[model samples]
Target: MFRDRGPAWRQANAGHVSLGQLKVTSAIESCRRASLGGHVERSEDCVHTQIAYNACRNRHCPKCQGAAAKQWLAEREADLLPVLYFHVVFTLPAGIADIAYQNKAVIYDLVFKASAETLTTIAADPKHLGARIGITSVLHSWGSALTQHPHVHMIVPGGGISPDGTRWVSCRPGFFLPVRVLSRLYRRLLLEKLIATHKAGRPYVFGNQTPLADAQAFAAHLAPLRNAEWVVYAKRPFGGPEAVLAYLSRYTHRVAIANSRLIALDQHGVTFRWKDYRVEGRGRQKIMILATGEFIRRFLIHVLPKGFNRIRHYGLLARGACAGNIARARELLAIKKREDAPTETIADADKPRCPCCGGRMILIELFVRGETPRHSPAAPTRAIRIDTS
Candidate 1:
């Protein structure tokens, strides 16, 4: 799709496209191509040679997240606890999505802060769990159709450490927190922060949302949502630690849409599979087709600000004290840490081997860009060595 329509889209929407978006487009287009450079591998049996191009390694690119996901999962494996895990989602009202698109960094950060505060505060209340729960929150900015729907998915352990730091406190078997209580608190906190941010002259309102720049107008804009029920959905506890890993693998490094979901791409548009959450049963799994320009626009809207982390940890899972906290929690629960296997260096063990004879291939030569790879064997000559200090 990029090769077919990227240039025209750029020319038409030059004023709207961000440098980050342009860079994503260029990287995706050039990924795995000779333009980015690559390495040539030859078979040990001298039967075949293959050229493997380099990857862009951009987080937003659909084709570049496999190795990244593996590495992330490896790191998270050590942090997993044996307790039941709950999946909770905090979503911003659609009315705020427009403003979020214009001020992504600010609004997204606000969403994380407000949501985190709501969870921790509610969980810490004496009437509730009254424990300092750990939270792993991942920010997702796109809905099924690639719309600008910003939400945070949190994985909360079924229990927490007591306030007195003396014992572990577990919630009821099935329940995490009251949705009604969480909704009210989240709404209040988010609105308060939004109003404060607007007052500080930091909120950016653009396009048809210009009227929201005024305090009164902005307040009025948020009036309906003040009493409206905010959606704080909590799924059932994961079956086990393996289930938690499986779930994280799906959400942690996901792009707006995976390349596998793309059914077709042509001059007409890009057609892909999408789940319509509003519908029920089989009707929900439907297909959506959007114009190439529209598709690109939707995808780019989800390009988060550079250096902004989409995944964050809080409370017991916070980076500064997570290790100590996890250790303490495990000790209190009378749980022993699993001994990890001895680490082995696999740098050479995992190298690709000849498909025909299963023999190792050695690097025989290096080729630069625009230079043809010489298939001929090197001529024997006297070795001349140069020394530089």
Candidate 2:
């Protein structure tokens, strides 16, 4: 179906090299083997790409992210809370940078487990406005610059249904968990676990470094983060239930950026835009051009280890009785059934909000042929507007 993935993607994998390309090839092979039954034959000439069997499109695959986004939103419809949802991000420090790369499977798991565990345990404490909260944690391994910045972005319901599952307890506006406290606890959890791994000799293979060979060096490397505050950046909550669903859409099965984000891929390498967080507000919106090789390097850094679950549901949202509990929550909220469940598809963009402004959002324009966005007179605007012009 994707005969041409734009010039940059094609050139990045021009030699059929890079981990992303290889993973894509593997996805195609797997899709062919795992039959989705078959599509109905048409009397009219088939317009859609009919290359072969379709991808199961698990979230982790670069190729499968599109399909996975659809399936994820459909299932997430059940978990939506009547109250607002917070966007909380927990990032790992570079103290364990090399280790996370080599042991992505294990370390990424620790990131998710620790971040979720911290949010739940803290929220459950009476001192911290005690209540059990449900969480959807997604692991992101790259920064906008394409560096290995492994972190977990959690979409947590602002308030959890009370322990008795009668009513929801909402958090104050602009306040989720305190980031400073969350950072301290998260740092401790990861360090303690990393130490245990080193002690067990299972995951730590500190190759050919006398300094790292000794536990003191390892302890010192981790010492900074002990007092050093790891970051827990909490974004403002989405406006309401629909906004929360839209928030999850951007992350569901996303790569560093979509293939379409890539602008060009001639011998000059690659040219694309990226956000620069060092600046505030609109200043952060900037375009970065990189060598083709560098683009490959950055994208590859985000490639998760095999079988790693980037998105995880925990607490009341966890599998087993948790699924039923969410349904009960739905009942309490006076919400009805998911009538569109059987026919749901991800392609419906649903005017998901602009990440910059927590205002009403709709696709203003759509692109074709890898072209830059052209402002047409017929373009759609938001229910509310923040003058970008």
Give stretches of model 2 more than 4 Å off: 1-21, 24-63, 164-167, 207-210, 331-389
Q: How far is candidate 1 from the true structure (C-alpha RMSD, Å)?
A: 8.0
Specify the highest-TM-score model's number. 1
Top-lDDT structure, candidate number: 1
lDDT of 2 at 193: 85
Per-candidate local distance difference test: 0.88, 0.69
lDDT of 2 by residue, 197-245 (tens): 7777645554553366467777887787788768889888789889887
Name the weakest run of 10 consecutive residues (lDDT summed) in model 2. 42-51
Candidate 2 has an lDDT of 0.69
